[model samples]
Target: MHQSFISYKNFKSLKGSVVLCAAVLGLYVVAEPSATSAGGTWLGYVGGCLGGVLMVWLACLGIRKRKYKNTELLAVGWVSTHIYLGTALLLVVSLHSGFHLGLNIHSLAYAFTVMVILTGFYGLYAYSIYPDKITLNRDGMSRDSMFAEITEIDEKSLALSEKISPEMFAKISENVEETKIKTSLLTRLFSDRSLKEGAIYKAIDFVREQHSGSELIKELDSLLQEKESLVGKIERDIRYHFRLGWWLYLHVPLTVGALLSLLIHVYVVLFYW
Candidate 1:
């Protein structure tokens, strides 16, 4: 025989919540009847409030369930409910506002909420895409190995500098110091235009005039090899950084905008309404 058990707490929590939400929505619809409501019709307000409450409740449920057990299941449930209800909220809130947006705090709050939802959608897309990119990159490379590769190139570059003109050697040294050729994604992509390409072109032109076996030619050749490797690493790093960074750019600003709008909305509803 199989024994089965269930948590009364979870059942109680769910049941109490549904009752409370229904009651609140019912009250909003039936109590204190408005003769000429500007915001929305009583039915529209009821529907919107009910939908918002349900969505918020589902999100909270997702959080609470994850804390107990079956995190993956909870996460999936949470994301699904979040996306579906967030989309619903867009419609609900729009109807709740009755499509009348004036220069007021409530309108501002509504606008902010829309902005936050849009950014959040973009963030979801980013989260889904970036992990694949990170996995692809880490398939054969580790962070320490990438650093080691750069160090190897640097050593080669230093050796090559030995046969170059003193001025060229000094310039190379200055460039290296100014740009600490790390495997950082941001530094790799944005800083690539500054030094390596120009240096390689100049070095190639200068070295070609010298005999193949000469010290100047050998130094330049070694420098060219190292530069090519560094460029490749930097390119990959930039791609990785960009893959993750763009979402943050969208999500963070919108969140801040939402909070500001919420504050304005609360102030208007409390004092003006």
Candidate 2:
């Protein structure tokens, strides 16, 4: 296992180095005065070249890594390199443009690169922070297990409700059904209405009127307390996903945009030069 880890580490490092080297070489070639002598356009060439090379390198690294192996450390390092190099590409390309943007395909491509980089940066932040956030948010409970516990609680609740007023039992049943559908993080977080609050209020009002002196009221009260705790857990789960969702929206589009811009840059350089 140690040897395997070492091999994976070395492979990841070598892959990163190749990409870095290609980026540097591409920038150097573009910065050469010969290609832009008449127009002083070396900066744009250098920036575009560097950006394009980095994009290709990133793509190659992803494909190669996916095909050969899965290593957590290597994955982390690759992601770190991707983020920093993406940022550097933005700086290099922006400088290459001499900070002049206009209404043209070249400028549009540049804009797309910036958009890609910025979105990637957001994704990196999410990637770095989310696992910890998820752990903390879970409060030592596995989300799946938490739902299972809730299900068990629902079963207990239904049993106890049978001893109570029929109306109160029906209300508990409704709440249980609603809660079951809201097992996922996204559903809990984005739910516009509060299921627990609604349930609790209805239960309280019904108990005060219909079953004030019974043993069933006491059991119903205990179930209400359990429901409240479960609701809080679900809320935390939802919030976790809400934070994670932003990264997906940003990362995916930016990745696609970067590829498109890189292609445009490559085609322009090859054909126009």
The candidate that wins on lDDT is 2
Which one is best on TM-score?
2
Q: Can you write out model 2's per-residue Cα lDDT over 1-273, one digit (the tens) per residue? A: 433321345556446556765665565455555554221365555555566677776655556567546664455566556656666676566666665668866677778777777776666565566667778857898878877787887788788887765766797788777554344455544544544456655665665676477777776777667667766766666665676676656555666676876676567767865
When summed lDDT is taken over every stretch of 10 residues in candidate 2, the lowest stretch is 1-10
RMSD of 2: 6.0
lDDT of 1 by residue, 1-273 (tens): 311111222344335444554554455455664653334556555654554464345335434655766665444445554545555556556656656788877777677667656766765665666556666755567656766775675566656665566765665565445444435555643443432555555555555655557765676667666665655555565566675566557555655665566555546655776
Q: Rate the local accuracy (lDDT) of all candidates.
A: 0.56, 0.64
- The local lDDT score (0 to 100) that residue 69 gets in candidate 1 is 66
TM-score of 1: 0.59
Worst 10 residues of 1 by lDDT: 1-10
- Model 2, CA-based lDDT: 0.64
Candidate 2 Cα misplacement greater than 4 A, ranges: 1-40, 60-73, 178-197, 204-216
